[model samples]
Target: MFRNREEAAEQIAARLEHHRGSNPLVLAIPRGGVPMGQVIADRLEGELDIVLVHKIGAPGNPEFAIGSVDETGHVELNPGVERYGISPDYIDSEAERQLENIRKRRQRYRRPPTRAEGRVAILVDDGIATGATLFAAIRSLRAQNPSRLVVGVGVAPPDTVERIRREVDELVCLEAPAEFMAVGQFFQDFRQVEDEEVIAALGGESS
Candidate 1:
């Protein structure tokens, strides 16, 4: 419905202007969120950084997330994460693995951290699907004690939107599709966001 992701991001930037002037930090879920987050960083004259989160997948069916892990080893489980027959130790082990990935990504993305604690943390993503990643992203940001935690997405489902809205101080979403499927389905040019592009965006202070 929007002209594209950039236009959608720019609109979000307009609504979020107050935070920008107040030392707000924009954190993008890498690979996809970087581009949109970059536009926001530029408009707001704030700082841009990456917040890493890995989904805790269902046993055997690894693609389905039972929960998620943040860069700081924060674990959030679904109502019945125990139904997977996994132990606390096993989940901790997975958290360690994800933390390692987060480290690698931080190095690759140039390790930009604008002030996680006191600043407003505006988490961005190209879009939201099952809300698993976005859920993890918000919980992770919350642990950092940001003055405000916001979830910004180009699109999401209404249910996911409502749930996330409760957790964050603010939510700037362009579209809540009636029948949400994959995040890519809504984008006309939803290509894979490359790591190089993420690095380049980080290097120049996109915010």
Candidate 2:
């Protein structure tokens, strides 16, 4: 397990060395992704920015994601939603609710969304669990027409890594263990990431 996000970032940054000087943009899914993105941007000499996406939780099990929504109100539903008996109306309302939250988050960042046109865009998170939000982020970023899209993370389930691999040009994951439980299980210090830290990271200040 990584000692912390810093160590994880260092490893991901090394794997992404080839992208250095390519004018790549590291757009992190806040708040956990900010620290790692900071290291990657500094190491690759790339621009840092935020990409907002939030999970749409399943009914009765709010922690279980039924799908995810991006900043642009684009929704991507899990195929398993039918198995869960989730309804279209629920999905529609949840997407709206999530879009509202994403709006507030964008305002909090105080920077216009970065245009991904013709430049490599690397989306980083501390780790991936359900991967619903990452999937949503990828689809939304794809709409921006990035020259190339990359997924860099500390750890994820093997299945998740494979699924995301097909969606992006490159996938750099430090660990992809079988039988994963949660993202935090792979980190020794997986604490909650706060808004202040995200702001500091965006401003190029150490948090």
Candidate 3:
């Protein structure tokens, strides 16, 4: 178990030591991954940036992701999302709502645009649950033609780890427990990450 995100990031950065001097682009999922992204970026001597993607939740359970939409409005529905009986209209509206949140986060973060093409891109997140957002993130980053696409996370379920492993060039995950409940369960300090923390991690002077 990780003491905190900082400890987990340090371990992940050590595993990615090969890219230490490659000046890779470290793209983190906001609200949670930013803190770890800052640590990894500093350790690897890479630039830090954010990739915006939001999960489209089920009608009743907002925590249950049926699909995800990226910043560019590209939507990816899970293979068995139809099992949830979610209608096309519902999916469309949810995608739009989540996309709007992404837009607002983009404006708030104010991170300078950085391209992943022809660069080594590493996507980081605190952890993975359904892998919905990470799936969309990988697809979005893949479209950019990054020379190498890597994914690093703190913990994930065994099934989700294998699924994500197939999507990226390399995946550096610290733990893949078979009996998983949630990401926070694996960390001692799993407090909610506020927007101010994200802004500060991205080198912005948060007010």
TM-score of each: 0.90, 0.96, 0.97
Candidate 2, which ten residues in sequence have the lowest lDDT sum? 198-207
lDDT sort, best first: 3, 2, 1
State the lDDT of candidate 3 residue by residue for 25-126, as single tens digits.
999998789899999999999999999999999998998888899988999998898887788998999999999998888889887558899999999999
Between prediction 1 and prediction 2, which has the larger TM-score? 2
Best prediction by lDDT: 3
- TM for candidate 1 is 0.90
10 residues in a row with least lDDT, candidate 3: 105-114
**Model 1 — which ten-residue stretch has the worst lDDT?**
198-207
RMSD of each: 2.7, 1.8, 1.0
- Give the Cα error of residue 13 in candidate 3, in Å: 0.5
lDDT of 1 at 5: 69
Please list the residue runs of candidate 2 whose C-alpha ends up more than 4 Å from where it truly belongs after superposition.
204-207
Badly placed stretches (over 4 Å) of model 1 are: 204-207
